[model samples]
Structures are given as C-alpha cells and as structure tokens.
Target: MSQIRKKWLETVLKYKFNHDKPGSPTIWSPDLEKISRERIKEIQSEKLSVAFDYLYEESQYYQEKFKQAKLKPQDIQSVEDLHKVPVTTKQEWLVNQTDNPPWGNFSPLSHKRWTTDGWMMFTTSGTTTVLPRVFRHTQHDLKMWAWLGARALWAMGVRPGDVVINCADYGPAVAFWCLHYAMSLVGCPVIPCGGMNVQRRAFFINTYKPTVLLCTPSYALYLGRTMHDLEYPTENSSIRIIITAGEPGPGIPSTKNRIEGLWGAKLHDDFGCTEVAMTPLGYTCEDEVNSVENPVNVHLMEDAYIPEVLNPDTLEPVREGERGILVVSNLFSEAQPILRYMMGDWTSITREPCACGRTHARALGGLHGRPDDMIKIQGLAFFPSTIEDSVRKDPELGDEFRVELSKVGDMDRVKIIVEPKSAIPKSSYIDPREKIQEKLKGLLGVDVQVELVPYGTLPRTQFKSKRVFDMREQCY
Candidate 1:
C-alpha cells in the first residue's frame, strides 16, 4: 500500500479494532476524506494501477476490451484517463452474461475462486428497464461496501447505539443484505424484516422500537399508513432516522417531506446500483434538509469512486454544473469491477463544500431517472423525476401515481395519472390535477395531460415503485 493508504487503513483499524468512538457517522476518515484533490488523485492512481492490472489479468471481458481499445493497463493510471476506456452499459453487460452463463467474464473472481475465499453474490432487482446484472463480491469487497455503507448511514444520523430495522427484501440483491451488514459493522443491531408483511413490520416497529429504518421511500409511506390503518399508533414508533434507497422518491421534495411527516423521522437517501455500489454510498446530511435553498443534494463517497457526468448522446463530460447521466468507476472493488460504467441515472454534480461540512462531490437533484424512463415532449427530453418533482409538489396528490407516454395522433404526448390523497376523499382531484399540469407545463416546457384517479387504483409496491408506463413504441 502507498504511504497514504497505509496511514488511512491504520486510522480505520484503530477505530474498528480499538473501538474508537466517532464523533459523527460522517467522520469515517476525516484526514483522507477531506484531503486535497491532488492528494486524492495520487492515492486513486496507486489503487487504479493495481485494479486495472487485476482486471486485465483475471477477466477475458476486460482483457479483450483493453486490446480493442488499443490501451494498456498502465495507460490508464488515474481517473482522468478513464474516458479512454469506453463506458460499460447495461446492454454490454447483459450480452456478456448471455455469452458466459451465471457470472460474466467481467467477474474477476468466479464462485469457484470464492469457494475458499468466501464471497457474497448479489444481483440487480431488475425492476426497471434493464435485465438483472449479477455480481460476485469477496469478503474484502463486502467489508469495503460495509465501510462505505456506514459512512452513508452515519451522515443520515445512524449512530453506534442506534437499533436499525431494515425492511427491504433480502436476496441476491443490494439493499437489505449489504445495508444490514453495514449497520452491524457500525455497531448497531439490525432487525432484518425482509420476509415480513406490512402488518408484521408495523408490529415489530412498535414492539422492538428500532431507532433507524432502512427501506424505499414508498414503503416508508405505505408502512406508516398501514400502521395507522391497523390502529397502531405511528407517533409512538421508535424510529427516528429513515434511510431510503432503490428508487427516486425520497429525493423528491414532496416525497421527502411526506415520508418525514408520516414517520416523524428524518429521511436520508442511500444510492448505488448492483454494478458499482456503496463505493461512496450516496448520503444526505443535515444540509440536505435544513439548507435555506438547494440542500437536497446526495453526497457521493468520492474517496473510493470516481464519478463523472457526461452527455448521454456524446458520452463526453458535461459542464461542471450541467446535468447529465452519471458514470462511475470503482477504485477498490476487485471481484467484479466496472470501469467507466454508464450508471444511467441522470443528475448534476458539484465539488462544492456541503453545508454539513462534507467535502465529497454531491449530486444536486439526486437521481433524475434512467435511460428507459426518458421521454420526449415537444423537442426536449425529460425523465420521470422531472414529472415526479412536479407531481409530488402538489399536496393534493398522494405519494402514488403513474406517468404514461404515448403518441397522441401524430404528436408525442405525456399524461400524468395521479392518485388522490385520502385527505380529499370523493372529491374530484381536478383542481390539483390542473394545478399540477400548469406547474409541469412551466417546468417541463410542454403541456402535460393530468387525470386524477381514486386512491389505491394504481399499483403499489413494497419494494421500488414502478411509476413510468410507456406505450409510445407500440403499433396499433
């Protein structure tokens, strides 16, 4: 290890082995986290040197890719040169899986290699536009994931003594298993409530009274309502911190406010995907909630993952403050490492200092949306998040809704089918729908058709919410 890495690891081991108490969850490695940009690059270069060499040697996918790109492992030594290696997309990854069964060639170490080493297998939920992507992580990668996960949880106010209830479905997926293990590493007791129904989860929350909750934003609202409907007092629940991942709800101002209002708990967003996750465990601190303006930012753990925002069409870097698709490269992951992977989530990034005193890069609008969710109204393209930001802002609408895109005769059109909140029962949601359509028109630069449906008519999910219904490609 480089001297910087050696010292950094020593500091972390001191905290873990000696049981050193951290002043805050965000203070994992203060010395290195806030280190100068130049210093971080130097450390990143050293780690990348080893990572690239490993990729070149272990996997035929990367070996052939490097040859096709006419590049050597040494040529790309730092994050700056990552562009030289083409971005890996979900399409390419799925093709690799088809070409090679179970684990793709990108898997540096397969299950056979992990037999003696001990590894965990996780696959993408495949809830969105793409097929599921599988990954094999060794014990070392899991430890690293847990460390970053702790950083995210800490920023979200999860302390060592806090008891966390993670309600996500645990599987070969990302959220529950990784986050449960991460909270465990943080010295917090994690109640794995994966297989429980909403009523059972509510019962456990009132009985056990965990201080923190790990779930999707939609589930938080669902569970809280269920608790109330079941005659269980939601206010009496012990949860104070609610962390959401897997979807783009908590980041939406209305959704965030609603989750906070219902649970009486501060909501934090933990963002990452199956490909390259928890490297920085996207986190939100007090600033995300308390800022006078623009506090809704997700801090990327930059110390471990190099993030870039590039135009999806051109695949070139976007201006510093401009919004674009997020592409990430893992600095530490060795099992199934992805380099310059087009993460498909759209957002703008800023290296500016956070109000919460974190210096890591932050995504301003959180996850905007995915490629499959993109829609064109008039001449410009917009994501589901654009509509989500507009729809959730209306207090008359409930947290649930569906956005459908189709060809209205010869013109491309967008229709927002929103569900009314229980607060305004039996009344037509026309006023709110009109209000939302007006706001969306002004914000999205196109007229949007709005229809308000009765509450609970749309599909609701215990996991991630599937809000976009696109029928534009169908031929009648």
Candidate 2:
C-alpha cells in the first residue's frame, strides 16, 4: 500500500469508525442530524424555493408544463403547494427526451454549461425496453452527490480509514458512483469491482480484505458463497459493514439474516433512484432494534428531501404508520428538478426519532414493494419481497434464486426455483424442500411450488438481480 493508504487505514482503525475526530468533515453532522423536526422543515422550505425557481425559469420543459397547468413557480412557495404542480411522470420525461435528442429539456442548465463546467450524465437501471431516463448534473452537483451519499454512509458505519469494495455495476448507471463519491468524501479508499466477475471480485475481497462491501444484498450473499467455493473464508474476512441498495433484500427478514450469516457482517439498507438524484432518499443506521423493521427502517434525510406518503388512488396524504405510495420533491436538485414526483413505491413514514438518536423521519418498513411489483395469483396479491423473506429462512437455499410468475392452463401460478448450496448434500434436499414450501405458504399466504435446483444452476447479475420472471402473456 502507498503511504497515504497506509496512513488512512491506520487512522480509521485508530478512530474506531468515528469520522469527526478533529479535522474530518461531518457527513452526518451531529448538530444537523439531531436538529428539531421543525428546523429540518425550515431548511427544506428554503431550498425548495430555489429548486422551484431554477426549473421554472431555465427549463423550457418545466416552463411549458407550468404554462399548460396555468401554475406559477411562486404559486408553490412551500411544500404544501407542491401538489398544485402536477406530478411529472416517467413517460412524459421520456417523451420530452425523445423529442429533443440526447440530454433532453429537463435540464435547466444551458448546453454551454455542460461544456464550460464538467457534467455527468446518468440513467436509471430499472428498465431495458424503453429509452433510459437520463439525468444531467454539474460539477457543483458532485458536492451534493458526495454529501448526500456520505451522510448515509456515516449513519451506516463506514469510517474514514476503511477500505470499501464496490460491487455494483458501472457505466451510465448512477448507482455505483454515489457510493464511490461518498467513500471519497469520507477519505476512504474505494476499490471499484463493478467491472470484474464474481470470481475475480472474490479474490480481491480475500486478498485486500475490504472493511466494507457495497452491492445489492443479493450480490453480497452471492459473493459470500462464491468465495467459499474458491476456498476463501468470508466469515473470517475483514468486512464489517455491507451497505446494500438497488433491490429489496436487506429489508426482507430471511434474506437479511442469510446475508448477515454468510458474511458474518452487519447489513445496511439504502433507498434511491436515478431520476430524482444520484443520492439515496433514506439512510439506515447501525442501531440493532428488536423490531424487524427497525434495521431496514431508514431515516429519511428530511433536510434534503420533502417526502410524503400518499394514497395511490386518491392522491390524498395517508396517516403516519399507514402504508401508502411515496411522493418526493427534491429540495436541493439544481440541474434537473423533480417536484412532487410520484415515487410509485409503497412505504410508511413516521416522524418519531430513531434509536440511533436522529430526529429525521423514519421509513417504517423500508420500501414495501412498488405498485407494479404486486403479483396476483388466484385472487391473492403478494410482493416478491414477501416470498423472499420466506425462501431465505431456509439455510439450504442459495441466494441466487428465481420467482417465476406464469399462467398454467386457466390458473395463475407462482413457482420458486432455488439453488441448493454445495454444503447441502444431494441426499438431504428433502427436509429443506419441505420446509421451504411450508414457510412460503405460512408466511406469504400463497402456496408456492419450491424446486431445489443444482448448486450453480440459477442466473446471477452483478447489478440489480432480476428475480421475478413474469411469464404471463399480455392480455391487453
């Protein structure tokens, strides 16, 4: 290791995960984090004003949108008036981008601005058929990216001197860079393993022994077992913190336990998307609460985001602790401002302070499945996450598994195909097979046929693992 890396690791180990030990910048500032709920609103209101004005004045897209609605930027001064401005749908943004090639009119910054100041263009990794929704951010926005990410990292227990191995896929996708930037802001060494395959990435973990592994919860579990196949011990590795996002794994009880058990490390969950910003909307803390929801229950960084839980049908605000569709407005987004944008995610929010001692609003059960992710079978509706929680409780099953939704004859059917780990002998699949089927039926209220496939049979993606394969032909 270089002198700087050696000194950085030494300092991190010495400080014991505390970043504010004299000269380090406060990503999760104790003063800011512990501020009153009213004070957080005050800051959000102030920034919302700038975001509103910037989008209305500069972007022809927002100007046209406002003109059609006969709404003025001044009309929505505070977050209360945020409803007056209609929600900008993903289709509308895509149409705008299609009409105006490349970067699209969503960007308030001039074309010259891209050339003058360095800018980064990124898109969401959710879809494949449609043109990916792109976002433009200036060099100044890099600070926002770093700050937003580092704030969550601090809460998740990533320190200044730790070595972070990033396993999330790279390229135009915005996910990996945010974690990379956050690690930089905290003054840690981050290894980019997004390009490498699982085997190579496993080698790095065994050799360098990263203190933190950043990836989807599925990938973390995938790596842990893959390492074992290569005779590399992960439970004895240096990894202490595994911060995961991009999919619903860390929050699912069985899935969470599986990843934690395999790596012998704590898991942290985060929430975000490319359209709003490169940063996560919620941050999980290190506190281990007895409640299952508490570990995955994220603290909404209220200072930077205005989050609202709304009924998807009526668009009316829901009572605290009631599950509803999440609607969010960017408080500090300057380049591409999204106000009162429907997140389409199901969740509940409570303003109650967390055990971690922060006054920020907490996501009650983290992200409860998106509206479209809801699967209907024989008049019963359940999310893939619900099934995952059940499947993971079975120690015989590997993290690499698939949830196939298909139509068999006239009946809608759901089947779970799971890979048995090498540790489980072929002779002993009966107990686990029976147990997994029982768990799914008991937990999810739907009888799912569980098949135990051979050890390395299931597909794996380095990025968001596509677990749900909806094979129902379009009847529309």
Candidate 3:
C-alpha cells in the first residue's frame, strides 16, 4: 500500500479501537455512545480532516469533484464547512459506473487492494429503469462492519444467549450479511434462512425456536401471517425481537402495531442503504421502543457518521426540528467512505439526549420513505408510506396492498388495490373499502378509488415490497 493510504487506514482503525467495547452487554461503547456532544464533534472534526485529505489524494472522482467546487481537502476540516462540498446523488454514481464499467471511480478501492484484500461486493436492487449500482469492500471493511454492527445490535438488546434467524436472501444486499457477521461477533448463533420459502421459514421459527427474527418489515408481516395460515401461531413462538430493515416499519404507527401485535415481539428498525453499509446508520434502542411516544425514534450513529438534513428543493440545511432529506458522510469504512452522499430519506433530527442515555442525534419518526418514491396526482403530492399508513390502519385489511396509477383522458387516476382478511366475509368488504377511501382522501387531499379484492388477491414478498405501479403514458 502507498504511504498515504497506509496512514489513513491506521488513523481510522485507531479511532475504531479506541472507542469500541465488543463485550459489553448494556451499552456497546460508553465512551463514544454516551460522550458529551462537544466531545463527539471533536472526534468528527479530526476524522473528517484526515478522511478528506485521503479522498483528495487517492480518489480520482473526488479529486475532480474538489477541483470543480474550487475547494481543497483543508477547506473541509470541520462539520461547519460541510456545505462547501457538493451533495452527491445516486444518479451521478450510476453515470460514472456506466462510463467506467463495473466499479466506478467514486470509491478509493484500487484493483491491487481489491484483488489482495477484497471482502465482498454489494449492489442496489435495480428495480427501476437504471442499472444496479455496485460497491466493493476490502477485508479491512469487514472488521469495521462487524464492530459497528455489533454495537447497533447490542443496543437493540441482542445478547449472547439469543438465537437469531436471518430471513433475507443471502444475495448481494448488505444488511443481512453485515448482521450475520455481527451476530457472530456478539456470540449469537444465527439460523441462515436465505434459501427457504416463507412457509419453511415459519416452520423453522416453530421447530428451531429462535429468539430474534431478522428481515424486512414487509417480510416479517408476511411470515407472521403465513405462520398463522399454517397453524403455527407466531404469538406463541420463541421469538422476542423482530429487527427490520429495507422499509419503513416503526415509523408507520399502523404497520408497527400490526407487526408487534401479530408476533407478540418488539419491532426494532435498522436503517441504511447499500452505499452506507458500514453499519446500521440509524437504529432503535430499548428505551425508544418502550417509551409512550406514538412514533418511536431511531438514533443515528453520529460518531461513525455525520448526518445533515437538507431541504429537498433547495439542497440547503433545514432547522433542527424541520423535515428534510438526509445526506450522510461515512467516517468509519475502509473501502467506501463516501462524503456528502444524499440518502434522500425524508425526516428530521434532534440533538437532545435520548432516554437510552445516548447523546447522538436521533431521527424523529424514523425515515418516512424516500423522495424518489413520492407520488403526485391532481396537483397534490404524497408518499406511498402515507397510503400504507391508511391501508394498514384498517383491521379488516390483509397484509398486502398496491397503489396503481394510470391516465384517464388527460387526468391522472390512482386506484388502491387492497385485500380483505380471510376472516372477513366478501359482503362486509364494502364498509372497509369505503372507510379506507375516506381516510386516504383526508390524508392526501385528493380522491382515490379503492378496490377490495379477495384474501389472496395481492402477492406477498419475502423481500422489500413494491407497493407502487405507475401505468401513466408519461411513465412509459
């Protein structure tokens, strides 16, 4: 390795080891997690200085970006100067990868390091029209992932005696793999349910008697309902905690209550994207979950990450309590420590001390879906999560619903297809459908058609659920 790269890695690893407590049962790292706000900012400032210098020296993409912005590494020495740097978008990375093929220049991982010490490659789902964005990590990154993951999991009350059942497919996605290794570090035995179907997974929960279930919020609900269909009551299962990622769970009250009520387990939210896979950047703590707050908060790991909330329209910082999109700077990884990367989730943050005794900033109400997923119709804009909150609030509704959008002679039309629970008679669907429509109209300020389908009409997913289908001519 080059001298500059070696020095950068040594500096970051030193910070990681100084504050890490891998064996703690209550708090992962008291020195870091419970430190005063001033001390936290000092640590971030020092690391940000070194990280920017390394990125400027090694990463060609960042070098070009700095040149265009008329700034140098020294210009961004503290959190106060973060606005001088341009915010990075996913589309920019996609274009760079398209021009460069396979891996892009955004990351500092060179071919030599990748071949010698590469750990794994993770990619986006690529469900949209664009190609999937890929990321490669080194062996050094695996250690960071394990340490940070262990801290977040430990805060969520995962102990040595707990048996975790990971239900996500062991694909190129980063969440499950990171949690798997972290569980090993935490001394918890994990049941890898990657290749199993929902029915088989439900069976494993019954036969193996795992204590913790890990999957998306959608899959958790689907699995729990399927267990009911197979006569395996989830409420009676051994699972005590359900750790969910890949979708909004604890943020939506109706969805959170439904999952917790169905499985008789506490639902914890783990938030992060493929680009920021070093750890669960946002997580729920024991106190946050047990609090009487209607919508529980997710704490951001500020020591390992710097989160900034920017207005979606102006790309400027909003007031502390105001809602805006999230942009993060990863200060803890080896392979892909991206700076000012736009995560695009809509939320607000506060630096007030949490009841859990952590001084890090918490994302209020968790993340409420991304701005890219927001839908507009008839001069009104709203997110699919709003629709989800309305649909899931109705007790007669099943676990599946979809928002279908089409054009009706120069006018936009939205139709919500929802399934009634099997116990509800077909004749009784009329009341529930009308109720859902009324609630949606009140929430969105626009009229929408509601269609009631049979119990098994809509399909269920073992991964992240796709709830929107836009069939407008403009979409084509």
> lDDT of each structure?
0.75, 0.75, 0.86
Candidate 3 lDDT by residue in tens digits, 91-130? 8888888888879898888898899999999988876546
Give the CA lDDT, 0 to 100, for residue 438 in model 1: 86
Q: If candidate 2 were superposed on the true structure by all CA atoms, what would the RMSD be?
A: 7.1
> Lowest-scoring 10 consecutive residues by lDDT in candidate 2?
8-17
Instruction: Provide the lDDT at 469 for model 2.
Output: 82
TM-score of 1: 0.90
Worst 10 residues of 3 by lDDT: 17-26
RMSD list, candidates in order: 3.6, 7.1, 1.6
Between 1 and 3, whose lDDT is larger?
3
lDDT of 2 at 183: 88
- The residue pairs found clashing in candidate 1 are 280-301
Q: Report the lDDT tens digits of candidate 2 across residue range 1-476.
A: 33422332243223222333312333366655777978777766656665666667777888788888898756666666777777776777778888998878877778777778756878776554355777778886676677777878877878877999988766887767888987888779988886788999999999998899989877887788889889998788889888888887656777777777788888887787777745878767777323455336777877667888888889989999998888888765557667777777888888888777788898876786776778787888778787777666666666677888788777777788987767867776555767777878877777788887787888777777778888878421
